[model samples]
Target: MRTDDVLEVMNELVAFVRVAEAGSFSAAARQHGQTPSAVSRQVARLEKVMGVALLQRSTRQLRLTEAGLDVLERGREMVAAAQATVRVAEGHVGVPRGRVRISAPKAFARQVLQQPLLSFLQRCPEVDLHLMVVDRPVDALREGVDLVIRLTDDPPPGMVARALMPVRQLLLASPAYLSGRPPVRTPEDLMAHSCLSLGEQERDNRWRWVRGGDVVEVAVSGRYTVNHSEMRLAAVEAGLGVGCVPDFVARDALAAGRVVQLLPDWVFDNHYQGTAYLLFAASRHTAPKVRALIDHLVAALGPCAQPV
Candidate 1:
């Protein structure tokens, strides 16, 4: 191969690696601050130079072929090596001063992360902060978000993910509603009650309740359906029906008696609550801004930052 041909192929390899990690060109572009169309063209050009197919693309999804996956694994190592070479030359630079973009769920952004983040920004005026509230998982590199806060049972592959805390989901209803209906003392009791459901695509309306070693899945029906957590909470508070919600969202309300917990002995199991995570690219692991934000979040969330 010609020397220039090899160099051209290497560049394509980098683009391929980015696309694979991001899962879409649009996401990769957001990370790199380029247009989605531009990202597509670059990936296409790289494929042409390499004389191999890399990605299988459709309107809704992008998948990596065998060759693409191979390239992605090797390419990440190569990129890390290249970054290490630069870091060694530049040495450590203290005090991160730059913009940091973070992505989180809409409800979380408003109820959990917003205040603490504002405090973080106030303390570090030199650091510009960009926050994006999203309901679905976002590709950190593709969406141009420096970091992502995810509530998941498992982290995605090929990224550095730190668990923040274990979250619990609670089945709750307003006291006004529960006053008229029979108390929910067992999973079977829930069948007689109406339950507001969230997430339009959710197929199972069964609620899980676990006590000791025993678990029960209670089938529930309701007149209300909403995709937003806040709306669901509002409906439950309005005495529409019992709704399962995250502890963070319901904590204050529960304490204030605005909503009462049902079946305190039983906990949700199948959609077993897991830890929240702050995920970022391995490449930016040592960047000053990245390090500072991670430290700040860890401190803010406290014991939530368990190892791994």
Candidate 2:
């Protein structure tokens, strides 16, 4: 086939893949800003070229035929390759002008990452961003995001991780709260206090800490339980109880004397204790828009992290 012929087939494959993944022609049309008939025709053309029935269409749902399933993986590869080609072409241009989609956790995105993202957009007026703040891990290529900020001790396989900061979970209480309660001199002392905690997991009530070669574990309870870090911090500030929170969430409050860090000499351990890593597909790092955002975050966040 000629170059144009290959391009045409690839374009039809793109449309088919989108429609298949979206579950309906109308849905694909809405997502891609194309007419339903246009998308449907593209799929039809692809079926004609391959001489196989790809989809079993119905009034309620669309199901892929066996041939469709066989072609789907290759179609995804072609689309991804084409997207990478576009990104490489964009990288050659002098200016960073494009949309960069990213995902981050809810608490970190709102409390910490929001300002830096705004700062970057302000500096690079030509670039636009789509930020998805969700708690669950997101797949960059599958989710159609440019980058993912994940909190993990080790980056997952098949992705590049740029270390942003070390995330430390700190046990804390407002000075007002501590004034009324028994002092938390050690992990065992926590048994006497009302400890706010994330009740999401059974182990949440079982808090652990380490100092030098010493290890301490405490099982405690509170009047109120919440999974949200900010809410727990607020409750602590209001003197509700001792709450464990991310260092980032508690840092400013600690600095302002709104809250006091408990067990300052010990390292708190459990969920949410890991380095915040900026994750991306290896091929995506070279794209100028992605590179710009990555660099911007590195600069903005470097000083905030404790030395590893």
TM-score to native of every candidate shown:
0.67, 0.69
lDDT by residue (tens digit), candidate 2, 81-172: 88999977876477887899999999999888999999999999989999999988899999999889988886888887788988899888
Candidate No. with top TM-score: 2
Q: Candidate 1 residues 189-226, lDDT tens each?
A: 87888888764546548667779989777778889978
Q: Which stretch of 10 consecutive residues in model 2 shows the poorest summed lDDT?
A: 299-308
Model 1, TM vs. native: 0.67
lDDT of all the models against the reference?
0.80, 0.87
RMSD of each: 17.9, 14.1
Give the local distance difference test score of model 2. 0.87
Model 2 stretches with alpha carbons more than 4 Å out: 1-88, 303-308
